[model samples]
Target: MPPTAHHPAAPPRLDLTDTLVLFDWNGTLVADTDRALRATNAVLTHRGLPGLTAEDFPAKWKLPLAAFLRDLGAADPEAAEQYWNRALAAEPAPLRRGTARMLDTLRACGARLGVVSAAGAAAVADDIRNTGLDDRFDVVLAGVAAKTSALLSQRPTRPRAYYVGDTEYDIHCARAAGYLAIAVTGGYRPAHALAAVRPDAVVDHLDQLPGVVTALHAKTPAPLGGTPA
Candidate 1:
């Protein structure tokens, strides 16, 4: 059986608790990225644009749906915006699991929190508010526009940071911003895909977050064998 990780790693273990933990909204904390994709593709296909199959979806995951549509050959910006708006009307279900408890745990531990996702501001803010998880974060940076910039913007005040997301793009964003990138298998991508990046740590469950954080700041991380951190 896989070893269980129930708590955050202790100090002298690298005080990751001191660093603010920034998360990617869709996959990291909640499980709505797939729902968004389904909604998006439905509209795209109906509007005469081809929908993305799972194989091609990965390539477009990090990019905003509007931008992604354009990249997929939709030259009409107005039509793309309308397609996204139609998807939004459906209001995809959020997969927020143990989110409240998890947020409580992070706060009790004295760690700061932030959310950096490709999700738009309206969708991100709406979900955070609806879930009542907004209070848990010191910063909630969403929307494709703010994805990488949010982390870079916060680094001056909170130098020690960790980015938690489900995609390789999130890790790429983290690396670009110089923060520890922690990927969760629970999100958009599978463990193998996220593992390919060799993030500071990879978690299968939301509850394992503390341990993930601990490992990030850990002086010696059980020898991360995949990609460089």
Candidate 2:
């Protein structure tokens, strides 16, 4: 079941002087849903599996990606890897709306930024470079099979840490890693789908992110096994 929102009023405003904000790649920071779907369908056609519609893609998409491929009839890791390679070879997706502004705002406000994604490191790095966002992030951790493990490895204790993403999986990963979860609606999933995951908050645009992060950081950090405040 989706967790209920703990705060229903306007998102509070506060300082985020030394916070670390981590982002997911595909649907979070990059507007790649269309390109991703096209690549996915191409792979499906090549593998003799049924292709998915745009609506079906978000509702059914899963992470580690290999699991999604296996469900689509990929027999082994090598087969899934081939499909992933093909997807990467497809035209790159554009940056999401307000992505650059958001990064710049956070940087100017003294927040540390990073990316932790399941996409290949080389591919993500290349995209970051091409998009002119290379200097914005302090770390770019990619090819992550499970975000929770990666989060733990980077920051064992989640003080002033936040994970901004677009899926229920991202919310789960954030919660498991003890980081504040912020979901944006402009990604692959719709607003309601993101709300179902019960992140700390959900915003319709990236421009609203700074306020949400500030508010969450002002409150007491949620304990390891407790709900966020």
Candidate 3:
């Protein structure tokens, strides 16, 4: 068996000061969540597999594709893979709000940015690259089996961290990976669901985001050996 890698211990308190901010692409930063879910469900229905419904999507949304599909009763790996491939091929639109300004705020504040999503790397790369938001993050990770694992892989470059996302998966990932989690109410799962994971904070809109980060991660530059990064 492959050796398991261990993650470092988590901080006792959730703090965002001078920390790197990681985001989940689909529901957090981009609007592709609905599009992808819809497409995937379409594939599931067409293949005679049970379709993934929005009401039930979040429950299994965190699982990696292979396992998620298998657990959902996609009898063959080939069929499951094909469904996802077709859905990705649709080339959907991105999250409509805060795509530009929010990123600018983070960068201007000197906060480093990264992404971790269950979405496949190739597809996420293409979306980011093509949409031009790819340049917004210093690091972008895809095909992450779990968001926690993805966050750990970049520990060398990221500072004390916080993750911004829209589902329980994101919150769970942040907690498991030793980072502060902040849930956004713009997507599939309800804010309450995300709160169930006990995220450090939660936001109802994107405009209020900067303040949330500010309040949590006050280690702003002048004191942290760097300026507000």
Candidate 4:
């Protein structure tokens, strides 16, 4: 497991007692970075680019993912997208440890849950079903090129909504969409790397999430789009 950052003065610790919680599928809930890396390397090799090591992948990964591909010699965005989709389709990754427990805890606590992922709808749905979490999410937005767009389209009405993920991109998307961002470590990026983006909180394991959410909710008043002072 990677290090976890717990900044006492992080922003947007909105009350999530009745919040809508949106999750990013890949690194947030699924333990599939290794599988994803392998698939990516396959595509890189196919395109005659040098393969990336696991450690190198996270440090180099970024959103508007086309930029990352371009850095890897994928000059054609459409072709790169196609290759990535095909590679991922051939090798889908599995759920992380304690995924079901975390979902169950949130659901039991009455959090409206959803998943917004860059993966295709069918793939995300299939993974949810395979993991026995078929009915967990109220909304499942997949193959989202821009997560902020998807999030804004939802127009979440709750005073407290959160986007939980494991990358700096996730934090940016969450903030852009007016949701509190919680970045988890032990996924694609290291703790310090995630901390650089200054998410609301960072935890090493999903097991710690319920307590974090509860504590934040308990301390904060319900104000629409409230930011920490």
Candidate 5:
């Protein structure tokens, strides 16, 4: 005889009440760096310029797409931008591993969640719908030109706030907006790149976030910076 089916493991044990967590969309929640690289290559090849390889792309990748294009010697940055966006939408990327589970845990623990991204609204919306995470975020701010100002606008109605992302720029935005920065590895940037920014904490995976939050709350009500875990 087979055992009767029961629900999965224990209920979420972390108490994230009165906490707000914001996440960066592309590399943070969605595994889309490969898509970005492809787009970059498309632009470069079209312009008869040298393309970047996976090994060197991360170090060269920067925010403010316009500036990156300009730096790449794009003659018509606007046309290049259109081509890049089209390439990204051609095949949207999948969500990072444990993304849904982490969101569920955070919501179960009474945390408010949102996404702030530089990705275009159309792409972000398609991603949220395709990934079935449309209802996961309380607020979705996309196509943001200035992240620091954007991060500052989302005031938390809670006692503690955290920003989870994969880039040094994200750390800067989080800290500037007075949120505890939580960097996750295996995104757009490398671990060492994120580490040099001195984020409040760094986790190797998304599933580890709940534990980090628990420890931070239990040990230090106000989080100080931490080493990678």
Candidate 6:
């Protein structure tokens, strides 16, 4: 079985000023799965396709907005994107449970934080500002159609880095960028799907991040020059 949040890993006492931890938005940091599903269904219906049920949303979700649109049989992906954006923006999505605690814990540990998302730039910017988290992240990359390239550019020389997200594609991007891939459950993908991708670690909740960071720190080699990454 894959290692889970059930492991009694203690929070690290070491300062993590050199560690760079990046997170995916949407279902990972925000409790917006239902909101996303509503938007997707709206897009599908607009394209004359059958809407996906809540039960089917997880199975249908995928990265790179264009591909997801095509998978749903959208003939004009660009038009479908506009439909999705308007639908998603109709209501505000709340932060995921334990989001504040997890951010606080990681910040207290002195880790540099960032958010990398495939969502629209305007929507992501509005959400961060609305949630009062605009100042929290060191970097925020939104509307990232080419995620692996964008992520690689963000950490060109950092020795030890981590990317936490809710999907298998996120794990693939992390691996491509040479960051430790940490998958969180209860998001867009199920534990089984995420496990098949072989992320370095998996957790059930965001609050378990401190322990995950602590555990990863012990395993990652110490960075050269001892400077903040």
Q: How many backbone clashes does candidate 1 have?
A: 0
TM-score for each candidate, following the candidate numbering: 0.78, 0.85, 0.78, 0.87, 0.87, 0.92
Residue pairs in collision within model 5: none
lDDT of 6 by residue, 1-229 (tens): 2588654433545587777889999889988999999999889887789999898988878888878988889988877876787788777888988887777767777778899998888888888888888778889998888779878877753556889999999999988887888999999988889988889899997888878878777776665222343
Please give the lDDT score for candidate 4: 0.75
Model 4: per-residue Cα lDDT over 1-229, one tens digit each = 2235342321234333467778998878988788778767877888888999988988887766567788878878667866776676665577877778777777777677889888666667767877788888888998899999988766444667888998888999998998878888888777788888888777777877777676556666564463322
Considering summed lDDT, which 10 consecutive residues are worst modelled in model 3?
A: 1-10
Prediction RMSDs, each to the true structure: 5.7, 4.6, 8.5, 5.0, 7.7, 2.3
Query: How does candidate 2 score on lDDT?
Result: 0.74
Better of 1 and 4 by TM-score: 4
Q: Please report how far candidate 5 places residue 193 from its true position, in Å.
A: 0.9
Per-model lDDT = 0.67, 0.74, 0.68, 0.75, 0.80, 0.82
Which 10-residue window of candidate 4 scores lowest in summed lDDT? Answer: 7-16
Clashes of 6: 0
lDDT of 2 by residue, 60-169 (tens): 77776778777767677557655675677456778888789878877777767889998777778778887899899977899887899987665533246888888888
For candidate 3, give the lDDT.
0.68
Report the CA-based lDDT of candidate 6 relative to the real structure: 0.82
In each prediction, how many residue pairs overlap at the backbone (N, C-alpha, C within less than 3 A)? 0, 0, 10, 0, 0, 0
lDDT of 1 by residue, 1-229 (tens): 1233455433333333446778888767776656667766876777677787766665565455566667767777446755664565357456556666666666677767888866667777777877677678888776655467777876654446778888888888887877777777756676677767788767667766866666554654443222221
lDDT of 5 by residue, 1-229 (tens): 1111122322486666668889999889999999999988999999998998998778877777767776888888767877887777778799998899989988998888999987777888999999999889988998788788887777545667789998988999888887888888888898888878878788776877777776556656753332211
